[model samples]
Target: MFFAGDIGGTKVNLALCEVHDGRITTQFLRRYSSAQFGSLSDVLVRYVKEIGPLSGKIEGTCFGVPGPVLNGRCHTVNLPWTPDSAEIARDLAQVVEAGPVQLINDLEATAYGIGLLQKSGQGLSILRAATGAIGHRANQALLAPGTGLGEAMLLWDGIRHVISPSEGGHADFGPQDEEQIELLRWLWPRHKHVSWEHVASGPALHRLYRFLKETGRETEPAELAEALAQPGVDASPVIAAMAIRGQYPICVRAFDLWLFFVGAEAGNLALKSLSLGGIFIGGGIIPNVLELFRRPAFFAGLDSKGRMSSVVAGMPVYGIVDPLTALYGAAFSAAHSHGVLHGFR
Candidate 1:
């Protein structure tokens, strides 16, 4: 059996996986609140104890961290602690006795898992059909917006794909319209640098709602406002749920802006990577709101690219429907990469 984890800003998914019939699959899985634990090791130790009877059975271990990993270390932008793979290996030596712990970017793990998922022909939906041809394999990209945005590229060098992790999500935020231009201006004072992440991620949903409400563009409902103001409540989900139900106009507007940003950034990634193979949307949000994402407003921002409109609008788009893709990928990478993979900058 192999151990794997999908570590994110909001939560951590840990699992024990085994390869059966030439396919890697999880046997035991659990999710933990990331903020509750001080370190990755804390969660691992707890998981080790809770799973029970798996002592020293884990052959290899890998984690998909939310930040860039360099030389087996990562300084997480969203989480508080920095994790070192070598140290983690030592900490878990008594429990699993596995090899060195491999730390890969979450997007890298997702990319690897996406390749595996594509082969199975399951848990993937084509949000936008390819305008030209069906099986064009040249280049591909992934745009994931969750606690933060993630970007990656799959370079098909005439043979197999090479997964490349990127921090393109941190790149500058360029407005596509006058309304978005005003949104940028509103955000400039609050953030040192308002990247696409500031407007596109799970957390950004609340910020968008606040912007719309505070700017007098929309009126906030009294009861909903009270619920949002209550401490410890996550407004992002509340707004998203309302938008999904088509209830409140304010929530609908924020959701619309979120989709527009997703589209713009997805198009930007496609252009930068020349991802003709396809563009895959993976993340916490899009999968849950697939129907909402299929609307024209989302494609409007994507197809708005001035000169290269046709190039981008024609590329196929897919949503990763499986939630455990990164967890599966971590295990898959560990199994195939000999516990290590390159391109961690």
Candidate 2:
């Protein structure tokens, strides 16, 4: 059995996978609220207790965290927890004599997961561009927007793709039009350093909703207002649902702007990576509001690069609909580490 996890700020996904002849099958999977746990070890302990003992049956384990990982340790960016692979390995040794416990940046894991999916020809749903257009030796780029935006690149070396993590999500937010300039000015004073993540992530959706209401550009409907005002309520989902139903103009507008920013950042990543292979869009938000991405405004944002418009236009684009990509990646990496899966080195 291989242990794998996708550790994020909002939730933590853990799974036990079985690998046979390079094929991975999940034997057990569970998701826990990250905020409810004090540390990653606590969650792991609970998971091990919940599942029956596997003593010495585990071969290896891998975890993907949303932050920079160095020397098997990482202080997660969005969570109040620090995860160390050495400590985790030692702790799990009591339950199972597991092999090396590996920790990797979440985006790096996602890129690996994408490559694994492409190779297996299973559990991958393509939303755009022609299938199989991404050549085996071509470079690939990944852009995802969740609690925060994530960026990564897969550099193809004759036989395999190398994962490269990026902090490009924190890069400056560039305005494309006068209205965006005004919006930047509005956000500037509140945040001294405005980034694309500030205007494109899940929290950005709430920020946009609040901005429109405060600026008197749009009025929140009574029902939506009440829903947002509820205790412990998250307005992003409600707003997205309203927009999808076309029941609220403000929600629709906010969703549209969100897609525009996302598309622009995706295009920027494509240019920087020269990802003629393809640009894969993956995130919790993309699958929910995918229809909006097909709108003309989104394509306009993606194709708006001044002289490089032609270059980006020819590049294939795709949306990853599978939510378990990170989990799959963590499992694949663990299997590869043990030589159970080949051709990924």
Candidate 3:
């Protein structure tokens, strides 16, 4: 059996699985609120205790962490804790006595999971602003927007497949119009380094609401969230209120601006990597509001890649609807890393 984990801004989930025929057969799994615990180790301890005890020869463990991991150490961006994978290994030595642990950026692991997804007869066609292709099992990217933006790419260089983690989302936020430029100016003072995450994530949504208030727009995220809880409150009600009434012009503007930015960024990613494998968008923000993303404006922004427009236009994009995609991805990465999936080399 092998252990796998998906560590995110809000939660940390762990699972043990038996690998069989390129699939993970779960033995046990659990989730813990990251905020509630003081450190990742706390959750790990709880998980191990709850799962009883391992009885067989455990192979190894792998984790998909939201933050960048350098030299086996990483600090969760939204959580107030730091994790050292090596230290976890030392501690686990006393229990499972398993082998060393491996760590991967959550997005890269997700990208690998995308590669493992069964082909839908699409035969690896690229789709912009959507899920990536399969079969090639290489050269894919994963971009997600949640508490912040996370991105990574996987490359199969013939000899071996490698996963590259990136902080590309932290690159400077570019504007596409006069309105966006004004919004940039509005945002510049508060943040010295304004990245795409500043305008696209959930916290960014709240921040956008605050910006709208400053611009004389009155709606709020809390109010909209309350409305969302109601049976009749769909995205249209909130979107219409913000887009047309300008009741929360800044928030509306932010959302519109984000779609454009997301399109351009995703297009650029497709261009740079030639990820004919596809681009998969996995995160809390986009998947929940598929209707908002399906708007023509969003696609237009993605397809507006100057002379390379056709290249991007043909690229397939998918918003991951499987809530457990990242976890599944983590498991897939673990299996592949441990040499269970066979095609890596």
Candidate 4:
């Protein structure tokens, strides 16, 4: 058995998986609120205790953390806790004596998971071009907008694909039109340097909603307004749901603008990486609001580059529907490190 986790700002998902002949099967899984736990080690300890003793049965462990990993430790970008792989290994040794404990950036894990899915013929249904030809050895990109924006790339290195983590989501936001310029100006006072993540993530939905409301672009319905005013309320999901249902004009517009920025940044990533293999969109938000992304405007923003429009136009794009992408990736990483799986290198 191998242990894997997808640790994020909002929640943490942990699982015990078994790999047989390069295929992974989850033996147990659980989700916990990250805010409720004092640290990742606490959550892992509780999980192991609850799962009963399996001393020396587990081989390796891997975690996909929502931050940059350095020297076996990660200071999470959005969370207050810092988890060290070596510390985790020490803690787990008390119960299972697991082998090498690895920590990787969450987006890197997502890219690896997508590569595994593609190899297994279980990747998201392709958004193919007219010619139905996707570049086999070209680089691939993964961009996810959740609590924060995440970016990663998979480079074809002659024999196999290699996952590389990036903090590109924090790069400066470039406005393409007059309206976006206005939005940038609106955001300028609040943030000295606005990034694509500031305007395109889950929190950005609430930010966009506030901008529209304060500017009197649209009147918020009384019911929705009350819900948003509630203490500790997260308006992002509510706004996205209303937009998808077409219940409010402001919510609809906010969702559209969010997608526009997401598409634009995705296009920018494509150009920067030459990701002809494909662009995979994954996140808690994308899988929920896929309908909004299917609109023509999303594609319009994606292919809006002046001179290089045709290049991106032919590139196939896909939305990852699977929520366990990072979890699977962590498992793959653990198994590969222990020489249990050879499919992913």
Q: lDDT winner between 2 and 3, please give it.
A: 2
Q: After superposition, which runs of candidate 2 have C-alpha atoms over 4 Å from their true positions?
A: 130-136
Q: What is the model-wide C-alpha lDDT for candidate 1? A: 0.87
Give per-residue CA lDDT, model 3, range 167-207, as digits (tens): 88788888777766877988999998888778655566556
Stretches of model 4 off by over 4 angstroms after superposition: 128-132, 343-345
TM-score of each: 0.95, 0.95, 0.82, 0.95
What lDDT does model 2 reach? 0.84
Residue 13 of model 2 has an lDDT of 92
**Runs with alpha carbons beyond 4 Å of true place in candidate 3:** 119-138, 156-161, 217-254
What is the TM-score (0 to 1) of candidate 3? 0.82
Q: Which runs of model 1 end up more than 4 angstroms from their true locations?
A: 134-136, 339-345
Return the lDDT, model 4, position 281. Answer: 90
Q: What are the candidates' C-alpha RMSDs?
A: 2.6, 1.9, 5.0, 1.6
lDDT of each: 0.87, 0.84, 0.68, 0.86
Q: Pick the winner on TM-score between candidates 1 and 2.
A: 1
Please report the candidate that would top lDDT against the real structure: 1
Answer with 1 or 2, whichever has the higher lDDT: 1
